[model samples]
Every structure is written in C-alpha cells, then in structure tokens.
Target: MPAVKVRKEEAERAKRLLKRLGLYDGRRRPKREGEWVLLPAVGGDAIGTLGYEVLPLELPLRPERQLYKNLESILAERLSEDELKHLRRYDVIGDVAVIQIPPELEHRVDDIVWGLRRVHPFLRVIARKGFHEGKFRIRDYSIIWGEERLNTVHRENGVEIAVDLSKAFFNPRMKGERYRLAQLVKDGERVLIPFAGVLPYALVIARYRRVKITAVELNRDAYELGLENVRRNERKLRGEIEFIHGDAFKVLPELPGHDRVISPTPRGVDALALTLPKAERWLHYYDFVHEDEIAAFRRRITEECRRLGRECEVRVKKVSDFKPHVFKVCADVKLG
Candidate 1:
C-alpha cells in the first residue's frame, strides 16, 4: 500500500486534496507518527505532484462496517444510483429514527427500513414523516417499523427534553442552533423566549448560563412538556426557567422588559413587532425568507428598530435551507 507522509498540521488539507483528485484510498486508515501523518492513497501522477513524500507503508484497512457513514452507502447495493438521488437526510431522535420516503422510493420501504436498522442498531422506531401541519407545527408521521410511538426523551446540549411528536413540535435539526444561542447567552442576563417549543432553546441556555429565563408557549401540550423538561433537567441546570402557558401576544404585554429576547418564531408567523419591543438589550429573531429578499428582510428589521426609537445593529444569518432558494434566517438584533 502507498501512503503519503506529511506533517500532522497539513494532513487534513492534504487528504482533502487527495480525495478531490480521486487518488485517496478510502479502505485504509491513516496512521499518525510523532510529528507526521501517513495518509493512505492510491498510486497516481498527482500524488507525487502533491509535494508529499510517498512511501510503501502497510496501512490497516478500515473495518467493514466503519467504511460508510450514511444510509445511502449501506443501501447502494439495494437502491439504484438514480433512485438514491431522491433519498433525503434522516434524523435520529433519541431511540427513534425519522425519515421522509419520496414517491419514487415508495416501493423500497422495506429496504430503506433495513438500511436504517443496519446503520442504527439501537433505534426503537422508524417513522415516515410528512410536512408540518396546523398551528402547532406538528409533522404528520406513521410508524413503519419497530416500536409504535413518537414520544421520546431527546438529549441535547447537556439537557434532557421530553418530546411528543404527536402533540408538540420538536426539531432535532435545531440542535446546533440551540447550542449556538446557548453559547451567546451570558450569566446574570434576564432572557425571554416566546413561541418556545418544549423549551428546547430555554433548557439549553439555562443548562449553561446562570441566568433567569422566562419562556412562553402557546401550545398547551408543548407547555406541559416544557414544564416536564424543566423538571427533568432541574438538577443539571445552572440557570432558572419560568415557563408560561399562554399566547405570547397576551403574555408578553403583561411582563417586563428583559436583557435579551429569543423568538423561535413559528413559520408564517411574524412576531418581530410583538417580541422586539419586549427586549431591553438584544433580540434573536428567527424567520423564513427567500434568498433574494434577505437584504429586504434586514432593512425591514432596521426600519422596525427605527420605528421603536431603538438604535440597533441587525445582522441576518441564514440558519438552514427551508426549500429551494428559501432559507431559515436568524436576525441577531443588538439594541443600543
């Protein structure tokens, strides 16, 4: 086997270049020496041109099961390359694995289920999901395999959140976003969260910062689950959470201003006018917008700040892709 010897710091960059040039060997694992890394690669003219010393080193082959990281790879033998293009990314929530099977892959449900099970041996349920519907934003789901339940205690960012997909809305994809918000929060700051679903943002923030967070949710089921999540993570939390069960429109008016406000606004609901005024210092507002309308969206927020007589700096960050040319954005508004 041929391996390229490069410094440890340059190993990753070199490996990427090798992979991009179609010279990197995937079956073998890289070896680390004292100050150098031996990257596994196949023989090619470009390998020598990569400016690394090539030597005959016997690299260990990767374990058969550790070769592929995604479900598509495991199902490559079963699904055609054309059919595989329609496969969507799946999410694993606690013991349940949720996937969306397109119309093209309908006939291969059993194979898909088998692939999921093969990839995740500990999954208790496999569910086929539909679009979010109604006011609660709960997705339509049907159990396709294993246990028949959507209720699970999902653990993220050092907090345990009890979620019922049938009742309350919970998006595991927002785990990174929740962690990002948690990192931005400071201790002793008074934080407010409206449209707080299952207290995911609240619980994650409270887990890290020693601050007081008032979270309001309109969904009774989500509020109840949020209460349970607070209790479940009570001992682990470093901060305090006051969960309110009511419409934010009615509840926020009765409450005082806070140091910071986070509005994980529901899709199609514009709460900027409702939540922005309640923030004394900063507001993290989330919404969906078209790619071309991003500048317009920022201008709208800036105008809203001006109308409220607050000097603010608004920066819009694209959080995730909602659809083609559409993105889920977060406007981090800093009030002066």
Candidate 2:
C-alpha cells in the first residue's frame, strides 16, 4: 500500500497497543521502506513492530568470523531476558556482523566483553575505551587496554573528541546533544550527572548553559578520568563541572534537589532496569530527535509524561543515522 496509508494504520495501532507494544530501537529502521508491520514477540514480554519503512533484518547467527556475535548474542539475550525488552539488529555481511546498540546498555559492559571472549578469542566485544589518556589521566581513571583498540571519532564545539580505546569509555557525536541541551537548560541551574561516564554530557550542558554541574560517578577509575577531562578542557569550554567520587544512587539521597539532572551513562533509560546507582531523572529520552518522526516520538513521550502528571518537553538535539535504519537520539528530559 501507500506510505501515507500504512503510517496511518501504524499510528492507530501503536496508539491502541502502547500497553503491549513499545518502540523498536528507533534503530532497526527502514524494515522495508514505508511498510508497517505488527510483529510477533522476539523472545517473550516484548512486542516489536515496524512501520512505514522499518523492518527487522535477521541474519543467520554466524558465530565464526562474526566479530561480536558472542557479545551481541549475550547482550541481546541478557537484555531481552532481564528487561524482556531491548532493541537489537545484526548485519551479516558474509561471515562478519556489526551490531549497533543503544548507550543505555553500558552497565553490563564487562559482561558484554566477557561474553564475547567466551564465544571465541577472535570475536571481539569492543569498547571505545577512553576519549583521552596519558599524563592527563589520573591513577584511578587509567584503563588497561590491548595494543590495538576501537575509537569513535567525534567533534564538538570545534574540539574533536577522538577516543583513545586504551583509556576512555565513550566518544559520542555531541553535535545534536550540544544543541538539545541548550534548549532544555537555563543559567544557574544545578545540573547533576550521575554515573557520569565521561563527563561529556555534563560539560556540554555547562558550556552551553551558564550552569553548575555536580557530576558523580561510582567507578573510581572513571570518576578520576572524568574529573581530569573537565579540568583539562576547562579553559576550552565555559562553566564549572564538579566531579563527585561516589555512587549517584546513594549520593542523590544525601544532596539537595537541583535545577536539573543529566544522566550521561549511555546505557541509561527505564529506572527499574538500572539497579546500581541511579540519578532518578533519566528513564526518559536521551536521544535528540530532529524533524521526520520527531513529532510522533515526542508526542508519545509527552503523552506518557502527562499520564504520570509530569511536565516535560521534547528537545531534539542531534540527528544522525547510526547505520542504515538505526538512528541515535539524545534529548533532555525536564521536570517542572
């Protein structure tokens, strides 16, 4: 049928089934351009569907030569089993597979890597590791990495955030974020970043908004590195970002409420899924939606916020296609 008709049907179906159905990774996109499908449950507990151009592309589970098949499988199974939900897609080009995942799945980070190792020595579950390293890196933040590593080449406000896998955890494309954050915050806001993986989000916010950030991280090593990065680049970026060396879940209770809170841990969303240290304010959008389906996605979140009596807005900060159909979003959630 036509794309317009299919979208109308998909929208209607999604509206009625919100309780049973959830959005796909917003990744796994372009299933079959302009076609909407109501799919069966992948494992159990989660109902996935594609609409007006998105469909699932399932490839043969090729473990050999599939670089991260073990890791992907382990993560896919674990996330689906634990949350009974997660967005996953595997691209099988010959014997190799590249699986793109949301940032919210970073906590079980170690398990992801270990699982990959268990699968086969050749299959590598990768991590961007660190954005920066060396004399600038504090003792606790120093990471031990193999001679060779993967890196995410990102640029923000002119300073390129190139990952040095031997050291950092994330190297994000912050263009969308820099703008999205600007839309949500104001001057003098007390922004809190719990589990501040790399401090990019917090710093980005302060630089854009004349705000104060109290960044917290439980990982001693990560905390120190975050602290150093903030200081090292302080001159470059405007505003102050204080790194708190402790768990945000525990830390939040002791501290007073703030003007705003930022949870930069890539694997952040759905408060219930996170058991460690949570900073409460996440479990909302971190993806910046621009045009296209922005209105639809934003409307969904807005409606949910209203149902719970919470006041919020949809701020689209970035828009980039991760893969062919998978897109990454980083939007800010505010409570008034």
Residues 206-308, candidate 2: write the lDDT tens digits: 6677777787776665566576667656776656787888766677667765666555534324331231122234333454333477667667766666666
Model 1 lDDT at residue 300 = 95
Question: Clashing residue pairs in candidate 1, if any?
Answer: none
Superposition TM-score, candidate 2 onto the true structure = 0.44
Name model 2 segments beyond 4 Å from true: 1-155, 158-164, 272-284, 287-309, 313-327, 331-334
Q: What are the per-residue Cα lDDT tens digits for candidate 1 across 1-336?
A: 689999999998998889768788976899999999999999757777867899987688764324233577889989999998888878888898888999999999999999999888989999999999987899999999988799998988888989999999999878889999999999999999999989999999999999999999989999999999999999999999999999998999899999999999999998999999999989999999998999999999999999999999998877887999899999999999
Candidate 1: segments with Cα more than 4 A from true spot: 1-69
User: lDDT per prediction?
Assistant: 0.90, 0.48
Best candidate according to TM-score: 1
Best by lDDT: 1
Candidate 2, position 58, lDDT: 44
| lDDT at 333, model 2 | 55
